[model samples]
Target: MKAVMVSAFGGPEVLAVVDLPDPHPAAGQVSITTEAIGVGGLDSLIRSGALANHGAAPGRILGSEVAGTVTEVGEGVDTAWAGRRVWALTGESGGYTEQAVVSAETLVPLPADLSAVDAVTLGSSAMVAHFALRHAHFARGESVLVRGAAGGIGVIAVQLAARAGAGAVAVTTSSAERGARLRKLGATHVLDRAGRGAQDAPAGYDVILDIVAGADLPSFFARLEPNGRMVAVGVMAGTPPADFGMEMVAAFRKSMSFATFSADTVPALEQRAATAELFTAASRGELVAVVHEELPLEQAVVAHQKMEAGEVFGRIVLTPSRR
Candidate 1:
C-alpha cells in the first residue's frame, strides 16, 4: 500500500509518499480500503514537530480518521462487518494509505445515506464539539460563542449550538467570506478574529468554546457573562502560557468557571456514545460536514501546507493514489 509518511519532522515539505506493505488486521480488528482519509491540522502538527514533545516526531504517517469499506475482518470479529462501509479513528498508525488496520470497536457503521466523505469529515469533529459543549453543561437558550469557528471542530460547535436552541450563536473567523459561510451554517453573528477578542466579541456569552488559545485568553475571559462558562478546546493558535492569568476578581464575584475538555479524559464507551449520536444526526441530515478539498494521498504535503496557511475552512479528504 502507498502511504504518505512524515519522513522527517520539520515542515509540510517532510511529508513523503512511500510504498509500504499493506497492513493486516489483528484479532478484533478490520482492514479498510481507503475511500476518504481525513487530513486534519493535528496531522500537520505531528509532521512539523510542533508536537514533538508529545511524541509526534517523524518517520510515520499522520492521519487521524478514515472512512472506507471493510475488506477483511480478523478473528473474534463479526464477518458481517466485512464489506460494510465504515468510518473510524486510526490513532497514531494513521490512515493515509490504501489499506489500514483499525480496531473494530473504533469503527462506526455509516448509514447507507451518508457518503464516506461526509462521514470522515465530521467523524471526530462532531464528537469533540458535542463533548466540549456537554462538558460546559451548555443549556438551552444560552448565548454561545465559538472561536476558530471556520475550522473543523469549531464549525461543528457553531452548528450544534444553534441547533440546540442557543439564544444566540456567535463565531470568530478569519475573513468576511469565512464568517458569512459560518453564518449560513447557523451562526447568528460572525466576528473577525484578527482584532482583539474583547474588541471583536459581544459581551455576556453564556458559553464560550475556545478552540484557539493564545494571548487572547484574558480578552475572551472578559467576554463571558456573569456566571458564564468557558471550555478550552483545541489549541490551534498556540497553547496558553504557564503564567496565563485572567482578571479573576470579576470571575470570582460572578461565579464564572473555566474548564478544559479532552477525549482522552472521557471513558471509551462514553466517547463512542457521542460518536453514535453524531452518526445518527448525520444520517438524518441534521449535521452537515464541509469538505474543503480532495487530493490524492501523495499530495499530503500540499494538504498540510494549506492547513498551516489557514487556507482551508473545513476538512480536507485524501485518498490513496492507487488501489
Candidate 2:
C-alpha cells in the first residue's frame, strides 16, 4: 500500500508519499480499498502546524475522508458490507492511502450510480453544512446568508439554503467572478468578502452559516436578523478576535443566537444519517458537489498547496492508482 505522510509540520513540502503495509479492520470496523480521497482545508491546517492541538505528529497519515469498496470486515461486523461501495471518515489515518480501515459506524453505503469521487467530495462537505443548517432551525421565506460561500461547505450551504425556500440567499466571496458563479448556484447576493459588501444586506439575515472567523466575527454576528441564528462551522479566516466573547454582547438586544459546530465530535449515527441524506440528494440531482479538480494521489502536496492558497473554488479529490 502507498500513503501520504506528513514528514513534518511546516508546509506542503512536508508531505511525503511512501509505501506502507496494507491495513485490515479491527472489531467493529471495515477495510476499504480506497478509490477517492478528499483533500480539505483541515489537511492544510494540519500540515502547516496551525492545528497543533489536533495532536498530529510527524509521519502521520493525513486524510479524514475516503470513498472506496469494502473488501473486508472485522470481528462482530457484518460480512454483507464486503463488496459494497461505501464512503467513510478514516478518523485520523489511512485516508491518503490505497487502503483505509474505518469504524463500521462511519461507513455509508453509496447509491448504485454515484461514483466514488462524487460520493466522497459531496458527502464530506455536505455533512457539515446539513448539520449546521438543521441546528439553526431554518424556516421558509426567511433571508439566508452564507459567509465564505465559495469553498466546499459554503457552496453546498448556498444550494441547500435555496432549496429550503429562503426568500433571499446571500453569500460572501473573494471575487466578482466567484460571486457570479455563486449567483447561478442559488445565491441572490454575493458580497465582496474583503469589502463592506455585507453592510448592504437588507434588514439582515435569518440564518447565517459562517465558515469564517477573525476580528470581524462580531460584525458578522451583528448582521443577524432579530432572533436570527448564526452557526459557526469553520475558521477559514483564522481564529476569531480575542474579544469575540465581548462581541457577542452586542447581539443581545437583537435576540440573536450563536452556536458552533465541530464535526470532530459529531456522533457516528448522526454522521451516517446526514451523509445518507446527502447521497440521496446527489443521486436525485437535487444537490451539487462542486469539484475544482481531480489529481492522482501522488499530487497531494500540490493539492494542499492550492487549498491553503485559496486557489480552489470547490472540493479537490485525490485518486489512488487503479489496482
Candidate 3:
C-alpha cells in the first residue's frame, strides 16, 4: 500500500509518499479499499507541528475521514459489510493510504445515491456543523453568522442554518466570488474575512459559528447580540490569546456566551446517526457537498499547500484510487 506520511513536521513539503505493507483489520474492525479521502485544516495543523502538544508527531499518516468500499471484515464482524460501501472516520490517522482499517462500529453505510467524493466531503464536516448548531442552541428564525464560511464545515453550516429557518444566514468569506457561491448555498448576507459586513445586522447575530479563531476573535465576540451564543469549532487562523475570553466576562451584562466544540466530544452512536442523516439529506439534494477539487492521493502535499494558502473554497478530496 502507498501512504503519505509526515516525514517531519514542518511544511507541506514534509509530507512524503512511501510504500508500506498493507494494513489488515483486527477483531471488530474492517479494511476498506479507499476511493476518496477528506482533507481538512486539522490535517495541516498536525502536519505543521502546530498541534505537537496534542500528540502530533513525525511518521504519522495524517488523515481523519475517508469513503470507500469494504473489502475485508475481521473476526465477529458481519459478512454483509464485506462488499458494502461506507464512509468511515479513521480516528486520527491512517486515511492517507490506498487501504485503511477502522473499527466496524465507526462505519456509516453510504447512501445509494452518494458518490465517494460526496461521501467523504460531507461526512465529518456536516456532522460537525450539525452538532455545533445544536450546541449553540440555535432556534428557527434566529440570525446566524458563520465565520470563515467557505470551508467544508462552514459551507454546510450555512445551508443547515438556512434550512432550519434562520432569519438570516450571514457568512464571512474571502471574496465576493466565494461569498456569492455561499449565498447560493443559502447565505443571506456575505462579509469579508475580517467580518466587515457584520455591522449591518440590526441586533447583531443570535448565533455565531466561528471557524477562525485568532486576533479577530474579540471583534466577532462584540458582534454577538445580547444573550447570543458563539461556538468556536476550528482555529484555522491560529489560537486566540489566552485571555481572549476576558471579553466575554467583561460583557457579562449582555449575558452572551462562548464555547468551543469538536465532533470528537459527541458520542459515537450520535455521530454515526448524524452522519447518516447528512448523507441522506445530500443524496436527496436537500444538502450540497461543496468539493473544491479532487486530486490523486499522492498529491496530499499539494492539498495541504492549497488549504494552508486559503486558496480552496470547499473540501479538497483525494482520490486514492486515481493512482
Candidate 4:
C-alpha cells in the first residue's frame, strides 16, 4: 500500500509518498480500502510541529479522518461491516494509506445518500461543531455567530447553527468568494474579515463560535447578550495574550463564558452518537459538506501547501493510487 509519511516535522515538503506493506486489522478492528482521506489543518499542524498532540513520530502517516469501504474484518470483528461504506476517526493516525486499520467502534455506517468525499470532509470537524454548539446550551430561535466561516469546522458550525433554528445566523470570512456560499449555507449576515470590520457585526449574538481567535476577544465578549456563551475551537490566526481589563472582567460579570475541547474530552458514546446524527442529517440534506479540491495520494505535499497557505475555503480530499 502507498502512504504519505512525514519523515520529519517542519513543512509540507517533509511529507513524501512511499510504498508500505498493506495494513491488516487486529482484534476488534477492520481494514478499510481508501476511497477518500480528509486533509485537515491539524494534519498540516502535525507536519509542521505546531499542534502538541499530533506531532510526527519517525514513521507516522499524517491523517486521522478517513472515509472508505471495509475490505476485511479482523478476529472478533463483525463481518457484517464488510463491503460497507464507512467513515471514522482513526484514534490517532494511519488514514493516509491505501489500506488502514480502524477500530470497529470508531466506524460509522455511511448514509446511502452521502458520498465518500462529503463524509471525509466532515471528519472530526462536524463532531467538534456539535460539541461546541451543545456546550453553548443554546435555545431555539437564538442568535449565533461563527468565525472562520469558510474553513472546515466553520462551515459545519454555520449549518448546524441554522439547523438548530437560530433566530439570526452570522458568519465571518476573510475571502470575498466564500461570502455568497456562506449565505447559502444559512448565514443571515456575512462579515468581511479582511477589513477588520467585525466592529459592524450586530451586538448580542446569543452564542459566538470562535474558530479564528485573532478577533478582538473583548469586542466579541461585548457582543454577547447577557448570559450568552462563546466556544473557542481553533486559533487559526494566533493565540490571544492574557491581559487584565475591567471589560474582560465585566464580560464575565455579565454571565458570558468561554470554552474549548479536544477529542480526549469527548466521551466515546457521545462521539458515536454525534457521528450517527451527522450521517443521518447528511442523508436528509440538512448538513452539506463542501469539498473544494481532490488530489492524488502522491500529491499530498501540494495539498498541505494549499492548507498552510490558507488557499482552500473548503476541504481537500486525497485518493490513493488504487483509486
Best by TM-score: 3
Worst 10 residues of 3 by lDDT: 194-203
Where is model 4 more than 4 Å wrong at Cα? Answer: 53-58, 194-200, 244-247
Question: Which scores higher on lDDT, 3 or 4?
Answer: 3
lDDT of 3 by residue, 1-323 (tens): 98899999899999999998888899989999999999988888899899999987898888988899999999999989989999999975579999999888889999899999999999899999999999999999999999989998999999999999999999999899998899899999889888776456545999999999998998898989999999999998898878877867988998999999988799999999999999999999999999999999999989989987889988999998543
Per-residue CA lDDT of candidate 4, range 4-51, in tens? Answer: 888887888989888888888899899999899989877876777766
lDDT of each: 0.84, 0.87, 0.91, 0.82
Residues 160-261, model 2: lDDT tens digits: 989989899999899989989898889988787742565556668888888987667788788888899999988887888888777687558888899998
Top-lDDT candidate index: 3
Candidate 2 lDDT for residue 32: 95
lDDT of 1 by residue, 183-252 (tens): 8899888787843333444567999999888878767777789889989987888877655644655458
List the candidates ranked by lDDT, beginning with the highest.
Answer: 3, 2, 1, 4
lDDT of 1: 0.84
TM-score winner between candidates 2 and 3: 3
TM per candidate comes to: 0.94, 0.96, 0.97, 0.93
Q: Estimate the Cα RMSD of every predicted model relative to the unseen true structure.
A: 2.0, 1.5, 1.3, 2.2
Shift of residue 29 alpha carbon in model 1, Å: 1.7
Ranking by TM-score: 3, 2, 1, 4
